[model samples]
Target: MELRIGCRRPPEESVPGLLRYRIASKIVKRQPLGGTDDEWVVIEPVYRAIELLEQLHDTPAQEALLIGRFSFNVRFKWFKNWANSEASRRLGLASIPDGPANLRMLRRTLSLEMAYRPGGVLATKIYMKHIAVATTEGCASRPGGAQAELLAEVNQHESERDLHLVLEEFRNYQEGVLPAGPGARSLTEFFAGIDAQLDAASAAAPKTQRNDRDVLNLLTKRAKVLHLGPANYCWFTGPSRALCLKLAGTPTVDRPLIGMCGSARCPQATHHSGHRSVWAEHADRTKIFLGQLGTTRKTERTRLQADHDRALRVIAGIDSAIAIEG
Candidate 1:
């Protein structure tokens, strides 16, 4: 029976060009079987064939050829033998024996496409029966099954650990230890302010509980406060630029800052004392830049002056917030 193997192309080429070049160079240096220049010239095609083989080596073409050959051999040899033995066993033939020590080897050889083929149903049914028999006979006591179970258990443990971490963060927020923004004196005040806003919103809305729940969920779940940017703004928030659901495509966790923050009003932002140096440095740099400019660069100087003023304003805001008592 003809079997097609589906092999996904690797992201990168398996074989380096340097290896092929080395092989080709070695072949070129080898003397012809005839040991004479005249005869060697006649056998030049053999040398060209070797070069062609070297070129094809370790490439996707070679991989496909190898996979096809492997699948064909396994289907006709191992799978055919196993099926015959299984049929005999079902017929109560005592002389027929078990196919092999490990049926997984045969299963691994069958490609994903082969499983969906016209005659694949019989093969799949035989494989499933074999597995069922193995499990009933306690053959699943193998190391591979144990390892799989262990891996699943570890994943569950990690998930539970992450949940606890989130809960701890929430606890810190409740205790007023977590920084929220420049407008709030403490985390407690920040949450109280949010509660007050939610209350006001609930009063106007027909579904007050639902609106309050949604807003609270956004704060506790989706929002991720981070210290980021030139000011080390403690309140920089969102799922982070990388984790933001609004962003298109696969999100990457490596991005260091929130790209487009919503400032103090953002659910994700929180200012803390740790961010003071960032703002201080920004203000200092902007002041120095403003002093260095002349009247000739009026537009540039104006921009720099505005930045300097903004930096100073942020610094003042942070200080005022910190000075407030409970």
Candidate 2:
């Protein structure tokens, strides 16, 4: 048996009728009002009766039909989930309120008209690009507007000076606690080491628990090891971020930074609260061990100290070079 895939819906059918039929068919399959797939078979005759005019008009128009082109508009449904807790069972959906609508149009110049001859059937294949035009007023209830304003304010203040200063301050905090030596590394190195550690832990996790506690614990550990003050940081580190999600397709050279925060506050704060907990407990330890910034052995203390001092100078110099405006 051969399968024919029509490129577009019949043009003789009104856009509204075609869309209604498409949506109604999906609804029936989805059993939105409640019924098994078998129930659809029973109710299909009634639906056909309701759409008698469409069927009758389509049959005659399809015969010996010449070249044609057409377009359509449609409305659809989507749901947004709202969860109540970090560990919860029940999920609430917002129903997208108005379920915004979109429009799509296509045109085709057929080489031959096959609608007229015996055993000839007008078959269509449609390709549509749905562009959303308007949305329900309920969408305004979201904080997206406020977020845009906040982001604008942040962008205005975030001079290169700020990045340099932040790195400098971070270095100072590390140096004050650790012995001076050539062992110091940048925060990026520190995080990169953590990534390796997480990999090892994930590998060691039992297969059965791989997707549950074992993985969750690993993430929580990572978040803890890389804690940076109270601000939230959203790093779109190209492949680095993708690595965390098991999708290391292509790598990037320079990491692009985009600030996505409200007001002057860092956006990282708004991230899931438990993220830190997961990273610290399971992932950071792996990185620290793997990255090996310093060793506590007394024999290597002097050597390590010297290395630490050199590293601090680099960080401090980099920091001192940055000028910040109040």
Candidate 3:
């Protein structure tokens, strides 16, 4: 990293080279403060990654990729933080980074962070399903994925030129930016707003297209909520950043800005487990694995069925209890 930075820096200042030298010196001295702890270190990498992800999520396919990538990145970051910290590390918080515990946490955290993440995924599935259903319904009604088709066109144009420009033009024509043309406005003209008219047209877009904007809106909104930057999780209230930001007269990290998506029973739950330890249990795959096996094999079938039935009873009991409570 230092060498790369050094190569980019001016020959005179050798900014990155100097920074690397200082880091090397600090490492030799066994000082943690010398590396990432530098007071002047900027969060450029983190912000850039987030910006790129945001830019991609404006399209349907890229939005899916961004959500998946964001989920993975956030989970990886959480695991790293947990491993680095004393309290969580002792609890095996970061053990098996992509295991059930971490995946569940990521899924839960995502749902909480954006009420839309889960909803958006489900909506996307439903939309696709609806398209499939509509296709079979009748030829006339089968404008299957018309919205996605439109977005794909926009997305293609975005890749070819400026995305912001494409979006602005789309928004303007959709919002009636100009006097109605003699013929219905051409798709080409609908997307080509002059720089001078751009600001006013852009200002009117959000309100005008609020109801019509695609799933990308949900993704962008979620990204904003989570602060999933390019390289790191900047919105997180880590120890050093928290302290530094406070000193700089920034808002104090006082409350839980994000929600706890997991239940109290989750392995990574902040609360104490009712049992001896949350780690004692794992996701019960007895039934699933058993069903996949050759169930016709007598001995294996007997043993598997026994385990599966027990798991079934346990899950049923939990469900019943939850239903009664509700």
Query: Tens digits of per-residue lDDT for model 2 on 1-326?
Result: 01012212222344755422221222233356643322112133434443453444444342222212233231122112222233233444223433333432112122012212221121111111112211211222222343345457765555333444334433333344321112123333453454466567668874533333333343343333232223223333233432322322344633323322220222222222222343233334444443464555554555555544433443343333332221
lDDT of 2 at 242: 26
Please give the TM-score that candidate 2 achieves against the real structure.
Answer: 0.18
Q: Ten residues in a row with the worst lDDT in model 2?
A: 124-133
> lDDT by residue for model 3 over 143-251, one digit each (tens)?
3344455568876664434333334434444454331111112222323433324456558784553332342332232223222111112223232333334444544
RMSD of 1: 19.2
Off by over 4 Å in 3: 1-284
lDDT of 1 by residue, 130-184 (tens): 4342341233223233334546887677545544443444444545445435424
| C-alpha local distance difference test of each model | 0.47, 0.32, 0.36
List the RMSD of every prediction in angstroms.
19.2, 24.9, 29.5
Ranking by lDDT: 1, 3, 2
Q: Residue 271 in model 3: shift from native, Å?
A: 13
Question: Evaluated with TM-score, which candidate comes out highest?
Answer: 1
TM-score of every candidate relative to the true structure: 0.32, 0.18, 0.16
lDDT of 2: 0.32
Clashing pairs in 3: 49-230, 50-229, 50-230
